[model samples]
Target: MPGNYVVVVVLSSLAALVLLLPPLFAAVDDGMRSGGKCTNSCGNVGFEYPFGVEDGCYRGGGFNLTCNHTYQSPRLFLGDGSVQVLDISVPHGWALINNTGMVFNSTETRVVLNRTWDQLVGGPYSLSGSNKIALVGCNARVDLRARVKVKHGGRGGDDDTGSNLISSCTAVCPLDLEDMTPVFAIGSGGSSAACSGVGCCQADINLDIPSSYTIQIHNLQELGGSISPTDLVFISKEEFSYTNDMAFGNNIPQALPALLDWYISSDPSECTYESAPDCLSANSFCHAYDLGYKCHCSDGYQGNPYIRGGCHDIDECKSPQDYSCYGNCNNTPGSHICDCPRGYERNASTPNGCKDIDECGHRETYQCYGECINFPGGFDCLCYHGTDGDPRKEGGCLPVKHHLSARDLGLFIGLGVGSGTILLLIAVGAPFLSRKMKDRMRIAVEVARALTYLHSAATVPLIAKVSDFGASRYVPINQTEVTNAVQGTIGYLDPEYYYTGHLMDKSDVFSFGVLVIELLTRKRPTYRTDQGDSLVLHFASLLRQGQLVGILDPQVLTEGGGEVMEVALLAGMCTRMTGQDRPTMREVEMGLENLRVSKKLASHDTASSSLVSQMAEHRMIATGDMEESSIQYSMEK
Candidate 1:
């Protein structure tokens, strides 16, 4: 009862294991037999469909097997009792069977041993290519002859030869003939006991077996005066080793292990691209072998392809060693998708299927104009070397200037005075401006030095003629120049210059203010609303209402940020009705410079909480300078 219980448990466990396997491999087609439950095992070997012990259980007569109960233990044989089956590998389409060595006496010049196929004749079985013929004798040469099945390229099908010699080997005693002993017994040096042409030899079958073969042993030299020693030959698996019993041709095994190839169908062209009825399992296909056709599961599926729905999708995600996925793995019907995690990207070169994105390395997308420090998933674009501002924009990172300079004052003066001012002001103010105008004042100074030398060439105290003389009017720093008539571009003309009939430096400053409004709003000086109001008037009204951003260019709002608003406010001060009410060009430039410095300091504050606290007091002083010095238009004349 205990043994029965153990058997029940083992059977149940095996069933469960089969169920857990992919449908293609389930039970190895064990349950495919019809007419009541068929026996799946005989002795220790278990088999499946296409091979059975009873009628209606196997595919055909060729697949029928017999379980012999006459012995103490049950033994499985092919059809009747000729060959005993040891193991059957359904997936590999091979079977391990027992074979016997042939023994014959040779007195004449040659002796021949022949065996015919019986139980396995006309069946889907043949001695596999993995078997070799071995001969054990002295002073004899053995040769194997068989009818091998050869497939024809044309429609003629297979061509079976009448008799073809496949392989041959010779054996001889390496000692005196009178000794009448094997090579090992003679203690000959450099002679091995293995099947190496000394007393024993081996040869490959080298061709497909057709259930029958012949072995001819020719006695090269007779060892005795009459009958020679018995010669033994074995057609066994290629892995079989020769021993003393085989060398002396005695105590030979009744059954030596040999591999036999098997197939599902004898039809060579049954499984073509268009049709494969023999492969009944879903997700399975038929492939042709040298002799017949075999069924195999399609890619990503496994199991017995010879049975209906016996092939199931392989869970590739479960086997990481075989189907590797480094990130979030999603298994599908016949395949799987591996998606990298957030902030990561797929990399074919990496085994993990993903690699971290170097955000800093991609400057175009990340836009870091400063020191870029890369980390896992993300990166830091800190203002490098004490410079401060957003590193994510053009000219966003800027050098930290502690004090306003005369050049900075002059640049903004130009910005508020002419169309060229914006370029000149930005040259010294921020990197967002034109690179051509950077250090414009310095370049002008150099040109002036060169001109000074040019003027020295004039004999009459270097009388220098200034270009664009019409654009210049003599006016003292403290006084304005009176003109006979008001003449200027309509949109850029100074109102006070026409009323006072005078050309003052403030006239140029007024025109510069119009240019600033043009830059910020992306509107021409002549641009006007349906109400016939100029861009300057509309801009000034919006600035007074603290709605300066409403009319600002969208691009300026994005790139300029808070700096745009400060620039708009400065433009308003320059366009004031009274020339004296508007700050001087020098004061305007200084204010713009102060705004740049403030912006830089603000960026520095964001680096760390400790730094923010440390710079808080200085930031207030900088902010106070911007408010008091930059846009605080003085009314004093």
Candidate 2:
């Protein structure tokens, strides 16, 4: 029994060790438990967790730094020996690198720079979007090209090679010194101090640059020959604005500060709570970045995410200015609360939290017209109705102007009499006007339908060319030949055709539109008001001002509902300035047909619903009578 118990204890110990070994090994491998043994600095440059110069200090090779002490001061570099790392920012995962210089041709007329794709492959660095390509010359042309290999399935399986992508920009100098004066000022030695196309131009690189790319500059041939031979072209990380003249004197810096994006190389799918590498810090999480994963501290916490117990909660109340809490602030684990005192409210636009309520804003709460005074936590209204005086003073408002003046009394009487006269006229003439409008609308519809058939369905299609007679003549099908001269009446003729002497189907459509407007207003096209305004012009003006409702006949508005609005819109479209803007006869016919169909379906649905409701009422009434009779018969028996 003793031997069996010993064997059981040994097996249990082995199981426990097996269960605990993974996390222990992971913590050591990720440098979280390294206890600051790693070299954290190279010269003046400092390093954070996950980045170090020695083994067992960094998460992986991409995070490794090479400290070169060849110069007077030690310098840091990436895996690529040629690229010197200037600075590393852990919070933003960005690294500033001094890029290589551009190569100028022997003639200095052309400049070229090449970047290889292999530099970024399997590396933690990628090109960022904040880079710009600049060309400094009076007339310069720049061409950027890249050769990208396309993978068939996004994985590194089958691939298509040598797809060239190209982008180009051209900058031209002003015609003369006078033309350049507004953009750039001439300095003491006749030098311009602007880079905004007067002598230099810059364009942003909107798309991501492939690992392998080439930038080429060419001298643009202009009327005054090629630009200055001292021209230069290069890529920059910072945006360029017209500040100083750097184009002529070759003052542009050779190396520009360029940003490189960095991320962890670990796969997100393989990361787990028990096996996460360098991501075991409290209050931190892992997220996918580019082709791998990166670690981030949780919301309300900030610290080095790769170290154990690194993330800490932020006490927002301690920094009132940062959080814009002007009132009493209460601190929480990761946030704060700002509370306003009694009778005060929060100010949405100000950093100060509480403000006195503007009682005048709430008109119903304090109905005062003279004055509304606001205090620190409250407000007061100081005027009474039907009085005028200084509201801030006590008993300020007193009764005044209670009696009406002679002019006021006269105005009131005039308004009443005018209103009564207008109402009386409307009451007496409404029925007669209604009858006349119905007749006009019927005639207009018939005319429109006839025109639609003549233009689209007749054996010999008709075209309206006569001006005096309201008649149309037949023309051969699909015959769009222009007539010799315009032969239409002066008032109704399409202005375009009248001046150009060109006849088209749209000419007729224009005349029909005018007729529709005439019918709606119950007025002749030649009719004018006392102001001598033509009916057609007046109708167009009202429509343009969105006053169609005001100008529409009262009878038409009463009976037509939305249909009148649609017709009015159609009329406006047909009478557009250009004949080509008019709708074809077939389209006009279809529009009217659709409107008729919709109206018929709506009417049928309403009738069916009414019938059903009537039948239901009758059934209820009959059932009631039957029940009464049954009860009466039972009593008699």
Candidate 3:
């Protein structure tokens, strides 16, 4: 009996899992009919739902597993030799799977893994959601296409709210591939060990799974290069640790019960035509699938409507615990009712509805709290002294004037005036504020110079005249404690900079990117959590896909087509992490001159702007100073 109950529980669990299907399940059209004898078994594993060996068994398509009986024990396998699944986990959304003996060497510092969609050889489904693409190697670069779900765009973090986004994470590390080392961080990097480039990598999936996946591992020294051939790529169903040993470079995830979903796209005409009465009762709704429509009782009812017998009504009154009632509960055939207790009069409108009798008017049932008021729904509990009328929301009402009379107020004002005089006297000699202001001005000038010099004179003239001169030279904002919350202009802040307050021209480049976006479209570099769109991100996405015209500012697009593309590419270069990689205003000028001299550019030139000229001067000073400082430091060391 215990075993029988266990079997039933197991069956129920499996049944519940089949409810959510993948997008590909749009192909299935029929229910399965297994005549009698169960066929193959791998030890304790039984072939079922999606793993049957023959046709007319699986409920959908794209799930094919082969039972290898070549050895004494039978083993399940995917087509060819992609992954070897070890076990299936229903409670925890994972499958114990691993890749075969392919290895990759970590000659470079990074490797890549992918969470790809697979159609188990025309069986009946595809796996999805938060699947981990594990790259067991050192120095990994995991580039992923984390797209938004087609249906919904974002994920809600709280328990009650809906989700907002399907996200992906990438991890990296550097270690000895043959040492079996965990590849933890070597020293101190600002990033945590979780993703601090020591060894492991992970990415989050947006809500929807794409049709397929593209994967590549790049060498930081140069792109489109690979490490030695000892590393292995695996899409794990669970978390996996990296080993520094030679084997780890080649260890892939073990294949097992990878979870996939099946969907009934439309109502099945076959099932509906074959069993009209039994399939869909008067009270039921028809769900058309690829094969045929399956029948079920109406929303409020449950039972076997697929059989000859009629679907029975569910009695909500059978158990008082079934329905949510505020007071006395009464049962009906398909629903329940509630009634208030004795002294409370029955309310005709709401269920379990009741109103308290006005006993205070009769001077009987309630006690007093300052004063009592009799109302239709209930009695009011009035309170005094730091209280309000409603005991729940506003505790009680207060009688004003227990502290601070007019005399006390006047005395405090006199004290404040005395303190103000003393502070003003100190302010007369305070050099700290002035010093700080000078430092801020100094930093601002440096930044202004970097920005100006990097701009092309022909495209954006470097004007020396300061019109919007919000910044002053030789004055330091550092003198004051108040800081810059957002240092760069909207378009130019680096996307890579977050959580830290470090400021420099690189951050300004991020802002410049925003400016480029503005030049392309009329939008600013603003982010709305409610609406998932960023001007910079939108433009960057277009550029990455080589869709320049789609994002180019219409006005600019009409003026110059080919020139716009070159400028966009230049803007991208300016945002590079290495500030040295950015072109100096002079270099930018030479590049621009090439186009103008070639007559491929517009005749008008705005490159000699004074602002840009000032920027060029500032850069000349700072870059020379920094380079000399670094060289001296190296010599001293």
Cα-based lDDT for every prediction: 0.56, 0.54, 0.38
Among the numbered candidates, top lDDT falls to: 1
Please give the range of 10 consecutive residues that has the lowest summed lDDT in model 3.
1-10
Runs off by more than 4 Å, candidate 2: 1-35, 70-73, 104-117, 145-158, 162-168, 173-192, 207-210, 218-228, 241-249, 266-278, 289-292, 341-350, 355-637
Stretches of candidate 3 above 4 Å error? 1-55, 63-123, 145-183, 186-197, 221-233, 237-258, 264-637
Clashes of each: 10, 3, 117
TM-score of each candidate structure, all chains considered together = 0.49, 0.44, 0.31
Tens-digit lDDT string for candidate 2 (52-155): 65556665546666788888998876642455677887656677776665333433333333333333344555555566766665455766666667668756
Give the alpha carbon lDDT tens digit for every residue of 416-531 in model 1. 33333333333344322221221322322222232233223222211111111134443333343445466656666677765666666566567666656766776766777776
Which order, best to worst by TM-score?
A: 1, 2, 3
Q: Residue 38 lDDT in model 3?
A: 28
| lDDT, model 1 | 0.56
RMSD of each: 22.0, 32.2, 32.6
Candidate 2, residue 529: how far the Cα is off, in Å:
83
Candidate 3 structure quality by residue, lDDT tens digits, 163-202:
2334333334434589743344443433333432345555
Better of 1 and 2 by TM-score: 1
